[model samples]
Every structure is written in C-alpha cells, then in structure tokens.
Target: MGPIGGKSKLKEAAVGFALGAVGGCILGATEDPVDKIVSVMTTSGSLKPVMDEVRAVGALGLGTLIGATALTTAMTSVIAGVILAAVVASMFVAMRSCTGSHEHSVGLWASAGFAGAIGTTLSGASFGIVVELIVKNYGMVGLLWALSFFTVLKPPLRFVFKVLWKQGEICCTPGSEVRSREREHIEITDWQQRQRVTLQIEQRILSLEKGGSTSGIEGRTMWATQQKEREELERRKLENEEAEMAQRSIQDWINTVMVKHVDFLAFSGIPMAIVAIVTSGFGLFGYGGHQSVFLVLLALVGLLGYFLLKSSDFKFWMLVGCMGMFAIFVIGMLTLHAGQVVVTTAVKMRAAGRNLSREQISTAMNYQSSLEAVKTAFFGAKLCQLGLGATVGGALVRRSAGDVKVIAGAASVAGSLLAGLEVLAPALGDGGTAGALLGVVGATGVSVGATAATAGRWSSWPGTLGTIGGLLIGALGMGKWHIVNIGLQLPVAYVFAMINPF
Candidate 1:
C-alpha cells in the first residue's frame, strides 16, 4: 500500500509538470513578448526598454507559476495546458503574416511556436517539481528555489523577445515622425497659398504700372487706390505669418506636453506599483501572526499606489508597470492567504475535539479538501475585490475634482469594510440560531444598501431602502442569507445587485 501511494504521488507530479509546461507556453505566446520589446525599444532608446520587457516577462512568469500551481488535479492540469498552448500557438501563427517579415515566415513562426511549447512544458515541469519538493520539505529552501528559478527564467525569456524585436521581426509605425510629416505637409500647403497670393498682388501692380494715364486727377486717384491695395496686401501677409506661427506653436506645445505626460506617468506609476507589491508581500509573509495588520497595510499600500499612479502624467509604461506590480502583488498575497487558510482549516478539522499528535495534526491539515476550499475562497474574494475596485475606479476617473474623487474612494472603502464585516462577524459569533439570524440580517441589509449606494448618488436612498427590504424578505432565511450564499443561490440576483443595485 505504501509503495502504491508513493507511485501515485510521483505520477501526479509528473502529470502536473507536463500540464504546467503546456499552459505556460500558451500564455507566454498570448503576451507577444517580441512585439512588446520592439514597442518599448522603438519608443525608448536605453536600458529602460529592456527593463520594461523584463518586467512584463516577470509578470507573465509569475502568472504562469500560479496558474500551474492551482491546477492540482492531473487531468485538469493536462487539459488546461493543452488548450492554452493551442490557443496561443494559433494566435502567434495568425499574427505572424501581419508583421510583413519574410524572414519571420510561416515556417519560422511554426518553429517558434514549437519551441515555446517545449519551454512552457519545461517551466510547468519545474513548477511541479518545486511544489512537490516544498510539500515534502516544508522549508524555506523550497520556497527560495521556486522564487530563484522564476526570477532567472523571466529575464532570459524577455531577452529572447528583445533580440527578436531588434531584428525587426515585428513592426510598428513611428507615430511622432508620422505626425511631424503630416504637419509639415500642412505648412507647405499654406506656404504655396501665400506664394500664389503674392504672385497675384505682383501681377495687379504690374498691370497698373503698364496702363497709360489720361489726367492728373485720375492718375492721383489711381495712385491712392494702388497705395490702399499695397497696404491691404501687407496686412494679409502679416496675418498669414501670424497664423502659421500660431499653428506651429500649438503643435509644438502639444507634442511637448504629450512626451512629458507619458514620461511622468510611467515614472510615477511603475515605482508606486513596485512599492505596493513589496510592501504587501512583506506584510503577508513577514507579519504572518498579525493578519489584520497585514490586511490594513496592504489596503493602504494599494490605495496610495492607485493615487500615485493616477496623478502621474500619463506615460504608457508607468501605467503598464503599475498594473504589472498590482497583478503580481494581488496574486501573490491571495495565493499565500489561500494556502494559509487551507493549512489552518485542515489542521483544525483533523484535530477536532482531540489532543492529537502534532504530526497527525499537520498531516491532516494538509488535506486536499481544505486546500481546495481555501484556494477557491481566496480567488473568489480577489475577483470580487477587483471587480468592485474597477467599478469605483472607473467612476472616480471621470470626476475632475480631487475632492469628488476622494468621496468615491471613500465609498469603495466603506463597501469593502462592510463586506469584510459580513464575512468575519459570522465566524466570530457562536453557532446558534440567534447568532446566525443576526448575521443573516446584518449581511443582507449591508450588502443591499452598499450595492445600491455604489451604483449611483446617495440620493437613491429610497431605492437602497427598497433593496434592503427585498433582500430581508426574500433571502433572510432558508440558509441563503450570506452574501456568498446569495451569490451561489441566486446568481441573477447577485448580478442585478452589481449592475442595477436597486
């Protein structure tokens, strides 16, 4: 029995590795690393482009790692991996012809796709091995190995894309040059018009000069008319020059502002996102016992990061960097939390109503069911948080005043706090009818009110009140009172609350 169990474990690990590699390859291809490298390189001439590419690669690598890790079931992992690879390979092939690179021919793309699949497969295999080793050792060494391998692989993958981009294996137009040429054309056309006017004025003057004079009074009048015409021509010429100057100045200002904004946003957002991720990571892993502290710290970091990124001047990479860091931090923290919940729940269940051996407790705590539940809850929370954040962020983005934006942010915070209370309050309460009833009422009321409030202005108090009343009547009992419970029991209700809110 022992030998058979060991064999099964090995088989599971092997399957996981194979699936992970396939999945990684597919996801990697979707990212179009080569195109991204080329874009950055063309726009920015320095190590900046390379660094940017590295960041993108790192994000994708981390995502791949997490995704592979989550697919614990061998069959599911394999299926997911194969599907991911096929989709990514197909996309790459489809886009290959669009680049207009004969050297990066259909054959070359096919070859690259095959290579990507192999690399991804290897990555997945490495992840599976690392995970298995970690499970066995349950030590810092295993964690370090995972992190180190990921860090090393990220740069090389990025470098490959960078090299391909440099070889002109991708194509993107130089927008600045295109705009400049367009402006030059407009200026040239204006200049031609001015020349034509000047020629017409000269022809009129020559015609007047060639005509013979009949009388002194008539000649004097003709002289006065010519003088007026000359003055008018001079005024028109001055107006044309002023218009041209104004147009040039406006164009120059626009170009300068655009460049400045892009640079500022990039600089500000990238650093802010990185800081948020690092801080969140430290809070999660460093102060494990004080989870509330970590959660608060993480939230603050995210809020600060959002503001810092938003206040930036609109640089493309700044936004990219910010998003990249955000994704990394969120996914990492969530994964850690999920793992903790799983381990804790398992231990609690195994040691239920007993003073069991530490080893027994530990072994029981690592049970698959607990881990799966924790993982699901963690991801579900993340998805909810992200969706809510996006909605609030989108709303605030439209507001020009910082004060108004702050109000929107406050609403988001309030909503999150309410949701947290709904989840945590029930856990704290004793398992009794009264406690359960109170939790149900409180959660239903808060969820309804908050959902309505988030949808629009505070003036919708009537609608908010109606929603709460409806939830209380329809979902307060029958084991369907919890927000999550409601979400599962009545998906339409949940969606309506999210969208309409009334």
Candidate 2:
C-alpha cells in the first residue's frame, strides 16, 4: 500500500475530476452574456429583456468576481499586517533585549492597521487593472468558466484540507496551545480529585452497610448530606464535560463552514439573486396571466420566512425585514421626489419656450439611482473599494472585545468620512463609487451587530433593534446628502458573510 490514506485521496481526486468535467461542460455550453443580450434585443426589439439579462449576468458574474477579489484583498491585507508587525518587532528588538516589551509594542497595532489599509487600497487599484485586462481579453465567458472551476474544485479542496492535510486539526492561534494544555491539566486534576471523592464515598457506604443500626441520628444526617454532595459534584462534572464538547464542536463547525468558505460574491449575490428570482416570478406569472397567483406565492414566501425559517435566528430575520421596510420607504419617497423634480423642471423649461424631450427630463433625474448604477457599482474600481471597506469593518469587529456595536459604529463613522471625502472631491461620487463603498461598510456593521445580538443563549433585543434603527438613520441621513443609491441587496452579502447559513 502507498499509505493508509492513499485510497481515500485517490477517491477524492476521482470525485473532483468528475465534478470538474461536468461543470466545465455546463459552462462551455452557455453562450456569452454579450451574445445573449445582442440576440435577445434583436429578436424582442425592446430594452426590457436586455436589461433583465444584464441584471442576471451582473449579479452572477460580476458579483462573484467582486467577492473573489475582496477575499484576495483581505488575504493581502493580512499578509501586509504580518509583515508590518514583523518589521515593528525587529525595530523593537534593536531598542530592547526581549523585543516584546510592552512599552516598545505601543505602535505595533497602529503599524499593522496602517499597513493593512495601504495594502488593501493598493490591492484594490491593482484589481481594477487586472479585471479590465481580463475583460479585454477573455470576456464574461471567462468569468463563468472561472466560477464554475472554483465551484467544482471546492469540495475536493475542502476534503483535502479537513481530512488528508489535517489543517482543521491545527486550529489553535498563537499562544493558544499553552492555554489548551493548561485546560487539559486542570481537567485531569479535577478528574483525579473526583475519583478520590468517589472512593471515599464508597468506603463510607460500605462502613454504613457493616454497622447499620449503630449510627446516631446526627451521623445519619451527615451521611445523607455527603450523598447529596457527591451526586451534585458528579452532575456538575458531567455537565461541564458536555458543555466543553459542545463548544468545541460548534467552533469546529464554524471554522469548517464559515471561515473556510467565506465567499463575498455569494454574500452580495444573495440579495441580487433574491431580487432576480422575485422579478422573474412576477414576469412569469404576469405573462401567463396569473398575477394573483404570483401575489399569493409572494405572500406564502413571506409567511414561510416569518414562521418557518429554521436556518438562522428568527430575531435576525425580523431585523432584516424592518431594515428592508425602511429602505423601501426611503426608495419610494426618493422616486416620488425624482418624478416631481423631473416634471417641475420640464414645465419650467416649457414655460421658457424651450420644450424638453422625455429623454432629456429622464436624464436630469440622475442615472446614479438606476439599474445602470447597479451595473456601474460592479466596475472593478468600485467593487474593490466596497470589498476593502467591508474587510476593514469586519477586521474592526474582530479586534473589539466582542463588542460589535462599538466597532460597527466606528466603522460606519469611518465609512461616512470616506463618503464625505468623495463629496468634497465631487469626482468620486459622480460615479457612485463612494455610495457603494459606504453601503458595504454600513452593511458590514449591521451584520456584525446582528451577530453579537443573537449569537448567545440570551438574545439582546435592544442591540438588535438599535442596530436596525441605526441603519435606517444612516441610510436616510447620509444617503440623501452624500452617498446616494445605497441599495438593500449589497447588505445581504455582508450579513451572510458574517452569519453562518448552515
């Protein structure tokens, strides 16, 4: 035999190869998005179908690519942080003998944060150039093929890491091994003490059995107390052991699923996917003259989401629904205002004896709030910025002492400042990049806040309510003045990124 695990490795490879072949075949069979758009528009003689196809492709392809890029940016930022820490440590080594002196380590965190920000910014810029090059050369089909390949490779890679490579076994962070060893020692000592107590109790029971009627009333009472104490200790010990096992299992599962498979595109794509699905449902039902049926189906979905969602905490869903309702209200008001502005401007022009066309009025209403803006949001530069902001927000959450609310507040403030910078510059928000980036930051904050609120045994309803309330306040206040068009879909990605779907 080659090795004990050779057969399993071979089987894994075989499965991967089969899946990859199937995925490749499926991807290869699909037409390019551009080709599909051209064909659909030519046949239909309408922009509606073309826009729908574009939305589907944008969400599926560009969203995935942006997510992948964000992941790459996060990795780069981590590497940058490590390098900066090492440099700072070396500097401290020259100043102090121990190299880890508390006084000398004051700038370590600052240096790491600075390096991470700079590194991610540069990475984002480079990603834009790379994306432009890829599109120039391979087109959208390439993105499809790339995503398919990743999907196909994911399972085998997971198995290799979890099983063959045993990466999951080495789960401790720096200095955690020592703590783990200490815990084990304490547990061993406790077990030994329990055994001694058990032996003493058994001896006492034997003595009582041998001399049953000779004991006084006080002695029998003492024995009864001892028996109760022994039972309580054993019960407590068993509970502790069970709790430890459960904690370990939960942590392991989180590591395997959420940490390992952090896909931003999927996170961001979920909202887009939902929108697409709902829109498609409407179109299909309306086309077949079953508009009422579509409404019924939507209501059913709402009911299921309200009552039967077992995948995630129910409180989270409620918070998301509230946030969504607020967003819808904001969108409705904006649309109504935009319509008024368009009409008012058109009338003024007509009164001045210069009648404007419908196209001209529509153009004045701002393209940044349209589907075109959604398409533009996924532009390489903008997507990279949004991803970087989200990564930074998530890092802030990690650095806190599990106080997600404070970190989220800090992140939102930072994002607002970034968006404000665009306002001062004016060139940045002209493209809606500022809005998109700020949206991701705000979304990340809420996602982290929601996680902290509902993750533990007792739900922090106040925290959950506060986070949602803050989101609405920020959306209404900042969105109108600085970051226009902060959509609801992108936050879905941020939320899913933090919350484990499984």
Candidate 3:
C-alpha cells in the first residue's frame, strides 16, 4: 500500500488463475490417454466386449466409448475440465472485468459441457451407423470419417466461439477491444477517485453543519483529514494509470489470450466423439478375428495418410519411421514363419470342425504382433498420464494441501467401500453398472491419491491400495472379473503411487 506494486491486484490474480487453468487442462487431457484406449482395444484381439455398452468403459478406451467409460471417465474429464476452466474464467472475469462476455458462474461452463456431451454422444452413435452404410470396411472409411469430423467440426465450433460465445476479448491487443476497454477503465477509475474525494469533502461539510467532531480526538483537525483524503485519491489515481499503461503491452495480451482461448475447449467434444466411434468400430469390426492382407494394407494406408495430413511436427516423421520398421519386421517374420504358425493355428481350428482360409490364418498371426505394439502404446500412455497427473497434482497440493488431503481421503473411502461391496456381493456384476461403479471408485480414488502424494501425504494409500485388492477379490468371488477386461494391472498401476519426499 505504501507504493504501487509492480503488478496490479487484478493482473496477479489473472496470472494465477490462468496457470491453474492450464494445470487443470493438463490433468483432464492426459488422465485417460487416447492411445491407451486404442491399445486396450487392440489388446483384446477381438471386439465382443469393446462394442458392448457394459464392457466398453473397462476398455483402455479412456471413456470415449458409449459405455461406462463415457459415464465415468469422460464425464469426469468434462466436469473436472469445465469446473477447472470455469474457476479460471471466473477469476479472470472477477479481476479483469473488461476481459470477455463469459458469465462469472459455474453453470455457464456446466451448460456448455452438457451441450457438448449431447453433441458428442449423438455424433458417435450416428457416425457409426453412417460409416457402416458407406464404407465397405472400417479401413480408409473410418479414417476419413475421423478427419472429416475434425475439419468440419473444428471450424464451425471455432466460429461459435467467435460469433455467438463472444470469447477472445482476453486476446485483445493493440488493435483490439482490450485496449479500448483499458482506456475506458482508466477514465472510470479517475472519475471514481475524484468522486471519493468530493464525497469526503461533502461529508465533512455536513458534519460541521450538524456540529460533528472538530479536533475532538488525538488533536486531528478537519484540514488534516481533508488533505489525507485528497492524497489517497491521488495515490489511487496514479496506480490506476500505471496499470492501464502496462495493460497496453504485448505481454498482457499474451497472458490474457492464454487464459481466454479456453473458449476453444468447446470443440474438444469432436475428438471425444471420434475416439468413441473409432474405438467402438474397431471392436465391432476387427477384434480377435483375422484380417485379409488387403484389409490390413488399407488400414495401414489410412493410418499413414491420417498422420501425414494431421501433423507436420518432427514427431510425425519419427512415427512414420517407427511404423515402417515395424511393418518391415512383421513382413520378414510372416515370410519365414507364416506356414508353421498357420498350420498349427488351423489344426486347432479344424479340431473344432472349422475350415481355415489363408486370410484368416494370416489375421491370426498378425494379431500376435499387434499385441506387442499395443503394449508399447499402453506403457507410453501410462507414463504420460502419471507424469502429467503428478505435475498438476503437485501444484494443487502446494496450493491447498488441506483440500487435497480431504479429496484424497474422500476418494479412498469411496473406493474402499466400492471394492468391499463388490467383493461381498459378486452377484452385483453388471458390466456397465458395476463396471461404472468400479471405474468411478478407481478413477476418482487414483486422481485424488495422485494429488495428495504430490503434497507428500500418504495416509490415503492404504484405502486406495485396498480398493484394487477388493475389486479383484470381489470379481473373482463371482467369476465376474473376466467379464471386464481392460486388465486390472494397469488400473492398479495407474493409481498405485505413494512416496514421501520430506
């Protein structure tokens, strides 16, 4: 208060809110990695469970599919992301009152997210039907569907942000609305400061007329009080001007835009829809069954084509090279061992009175190789999820250790209760119903546990660890564990973290 701070109160609050928003996005985006979902689909070697609404949530599918994953993971992300985005948006709006048209309320974000969910779910189901009707197979057709989706949806959604949603005010720079607002803000503050001084003088006059205090306490006089009020007004007016001037620079624009572009969060639904569709289709069309060489080639073409169009980064080239080497390796193995593997595979099939086609035999062999690739993808996804979770969780823990601890404690209790109920009553096995419950228990539990652990808390570990044990034991008790097959190992590993770094 003695001297004007380098940064205004509003600017400091906006920066913290923006950073927190980023942390939230990171938390939501990576919690359930898309590639992990794909790898899970591929791991099963078949689609029976992947397509089932009940079984899909348990898929590495990352809640993109129609089943419990959507209800649990997807829903969690939506709520978490929106709440997080809203909190940041609210902070910005509250402090930088000139920012954007966004309402300073949680309901706005919740409503937008709700609308997005509706659109995504509808698109996912409809796209599946459309793809089935138009394409001979889920090869290039599915790829086209996904790309076209991004293209068609991205722009329109962005338009909504521009025209209807009225975002981007935070992005305003020298040539934009923010500058205009900043100038207006200065004028308003100047007027308000002068108004305060005027009001104080008026009050003093009224007090004198009413025979109020005059040098009655601590030897203070009306003149001294009037001068102090005038000085305070000048100080405030000066700080306001300095802040206004600083707001004109490029730095403020960058910071504001970073906070405001969250409007783009609207279109994330398109990707969610795509994930649901592709994951479900993969299971429905290509799981566990053998693929003809022609079909596999088409899939490869689709994958390569999509990558080339979608990304130009160095990572794209690295992906292409890696895929090329894997393809070559596969080809070499097939050329050498195809006969032997097919003979053995076909013999097993024949004993069950089924005749084998060379194509089906080839599909069987390829399935094994696909498993290896899927594992690599799964591992990568897990590592990324954990790292991002840790980073964000650490930040949250630092911000409010007590809140994170409470969250962790709540999650562990809920998870343990879930595990115990399922264990005691194996008959409660419902793929989606029970799986969703389990997913909620596990997802919420691990997410919070991650947060608390980053804060150096371990009290929640026992209950969280007990959750995995309870789920397995309960599912096994009723032989229902096999019904859900994203595999327990990864889910356990996902939240199985606790270490103290004093």
Candidate 4:
C-alpha cells in the first residue's frame, strides 16, 4: 500500500492501530476465555448501529472515531479494559451533570457531581457485567463486531433519557391544568368563619361559669388570699430590683478599677520596662536550664512597676500580694537547682558501667520514663504559669473591686502550686501533697486580702512591704537548698546592644 492509501491512510491507520492495541490488551488480560471471545464478536457486530445512533444524537465527531475503531479486536478480553472505559465514561457524564441545570437548582454542584460520578460509575460496572456474561457464551470476534454497532445506538438511547430527565416531562401527566385549577379554587371560607364564631362563644360561656363559681366563695377568705398574693409579688419585685442594683454597682466598681490599672500601666511604661529588664536579665544569666524563668519574672516585674507608678489608685495590700507572688517565683527557681542535682546524680549512677544512648541518658537524668511524659509535664507547667500570671495581673488591676481581688489572688496562688506539682509530681510520684499546700495558701491569702480590700480601707505601704518581705523569707527558707546562679546578663546585654547598636 502507498503511504496515504489503503489501510495506511493517516487518520484511519492511527485510529485503527490504537483501537486494535487496546482491544488486544483487553482480550489477553480477560478473566474468562469464553467471555472474552463472545464479547469481541458481539462488539464487532454492534459497531455500525452504535455509530449511527451516536451521529443522530449530534455527537458525529466522537461517533466517527468510535466507528473507525469499532472493528478492531484482541486475542482476549480484559475485565480491566471494561472497568476503565466505564469509569471514564461515567466521570464524563457526572461532570456534565454538575455543569447542567440540575446541580444549579439544588445549589450542590460539587456534592452532586461527586454523588453522580459514583452512581454512574457503578451503573457502568453493572452494564459491563451484563456484557461480560453475553460475551462468555458467544465468540470474541462476534462480540467485538456487535459492540461496534451497539456504540452507534447507545448514544441516542442515553440522549433521550437525558433530555427527558432535564425537562422533567418523562412521566408527567399531560393536560392536567384544568383539574389543578379546580382543586386550587375550592374554598370553605363561610363555613370556617361560622366554626370560629362557635368556638369563641363556647369559650366565653365556660369563662362566665368559672367566674360565677368563684364569686360564690366567702368574701373574707377570698380577700385575704388576694392580699397574700399581692404582698408576695411585691416582695419578689423589690428583691429582684435590689439584686439588679447590687450587680450594677459591682460592675461599675470593676470598670473603675480596670480603668485605673490600665492607666497606671500606660503611665509607668518606662519604669516597668526597667524592672523587667533587671529581673529577666538576672534570671536568664544566673539560672541553668531555666531560661523561661527569666522571661516570666521579667513580665511580673514589668507589671509591678506599672502598679507602683499608679500606687495612688492601688490598694496597699494588693501591692503586697503581687510582691509575695514574685518572691515565691524566685523561691521556686532556687528549689529547682536541688532537683537538677538529684537528677544528675541519678543519671550518673544509672550509667556507671554500661554504655548509654543519648535518649537513655536524658530519660534517666530527668527521671522521666518517656519523651511523651516530659512533653506533658512541660506543657502543664507552662499552662500553670500563664494562669498564675493572668490571675495576679488581674487582681492587681482590679484590686478596688472588692472580693474579685481576693479571688484573683487565690487563683494565682493555686496556679503557682499546680506548676510546682507539675514539676515535682513526675519526679517524686507524690499525690495530693502539692495540691493540698496550694489550696491552703490560696484560701488563706484570698480570704484575708479579699476581706481587707473589700473593706475599702488602704493598708500602709510599710505594712504591705513587711508582709511581702515575710512571705519572701519563708519561701526562700523552703527552697534555698537549690543553689543556682542568678544574674542579669541577658537584660544588660539587650540594653547595651540597643543603646550602642554595635
């Protein structure tokens, strides 16, 4: 044959080769020999009719391609080929459906597309199964020929259904409008009005009978009962009014305290920053494996500095409480040094003879069984610290709000204790000890401070300072066994770098 002539024609040859290759692969990989043979024979015979139907449905371009390749066949039929074709076709249908009017009406284009794709794909598989069964009984060549003819007719059948569904006219009744109109026009307005009137008259008569019965009651007893009800309602109303007034007063007090505290912080920004730098620097440079302590202390110092600037508005005892919390933080840091020493010694003893992995060494030193435990302890401690900071800061800011200050103070103390427990519980395995101490300290301080602060009398600065000093000494006595360096290196460095910029 010439290059452009006979079976070697450019378009026909390419399409024929492709179809033949696909068919061959499908046949060779088919599950059953009989089914494969029959399927090919049926497809071959059905090609022409299928193409004709496809063309009639205005899919001539696609139909031509399918027609040209319809006769191509393979040695065997593969289940995969049928599955692949069905899936692709179903997906194409689903995409079309999504873009069509059905999806737009329901406002679920994506969901409909997904659902439709699955449904169609499954339907296609079912059709494939039917084709497989038919092909098993027939010959391969015959099935192939039949499928080619079937392709031409299938499109038209599918198109008819699509059109019918889109129009919603497939099973609808014709010329039913007259009946619908008659049904819509039917009315019983007069009867409904009469029924409503009858119900109203019945209700009125019942109410009159009840009233007449009540009027027959002894007048003195009825009068006393009415008076009692009136008094009760009046008392309840007064109580409600008093409660509302009290709540309003409390809210007003809180607002006033908040405004004063916020203003104080704003005014004392410079001094607060200085205090933060000093405290944070000391903690950072002096402590080993406790870098976070510096940051926490710095924040507290900054907050206190702000309070001092607005000392005129702050209650004396609130200042004392703030200072006391800071002292406790320092004490905790000092205590942690002893924990570190114990941890180091334990690790050393465990690894005395045998070679140990880095992970093992770390676990032994920390007295933690797993990395997960360490992570949990660290996270819990951080949460407790944050809670403590918030509580103390809120109390200082709202000290003038009576019992709120006490509550905040108590919460801060509890949070600190929880943080302590987070650290010690894992190492010591002691239950309730840490929690009990926290409750005792929190309750005592909160109750005392709340009572005094709510009394609306300010304590002297000397008295406030003395109380804080005493608390600091006590905490230090408890925690001073841990000796770690405490210095102001980081803050100093930061300040120097900022000023010099070198």
Candidate number of the best TM-score:
3
Backbone Cα, N, C clashes tallied per candidate: 7, 2, 6, 58
RMSD of 1: 22.5
lDDT of 2 at 299: 58
Candidate 1 weakest lDDT stretch, 10 residues: 430-439
User: How well is each residue in 369-464 modelled by candidate 3, as lDDT tens digits?
Assistant: 334323332333233223223323333344332433423443443344444444533333222222223223333333433433432332343433
Give every collision pair in model 2: 267-493, 268-493
- True lDDT of residue 72, candidate 1: 19
Model 4 agreement with the true structure over 60-174: per-residue lDDT tens digits: 1121122111111110011112222223323332333111222112222223222322332233223334443443454222333454454344335445534543344223322
* TM-score of model number 2: 0.36
Task: Give the lDDT of residue 364 in candidate 1.
Answer: 38
Q: Candidate 3: how many backbone clashes? A: 6
Off by over 4 Å in 4: 1-217, 272-421, 424-502
> Which candidate would rank higher by TM-score, 1 or 2?
2
In the order shown, what is each candidate's alpha-carbon RMSD?
22.5, 19.6, 13.6, 37.8
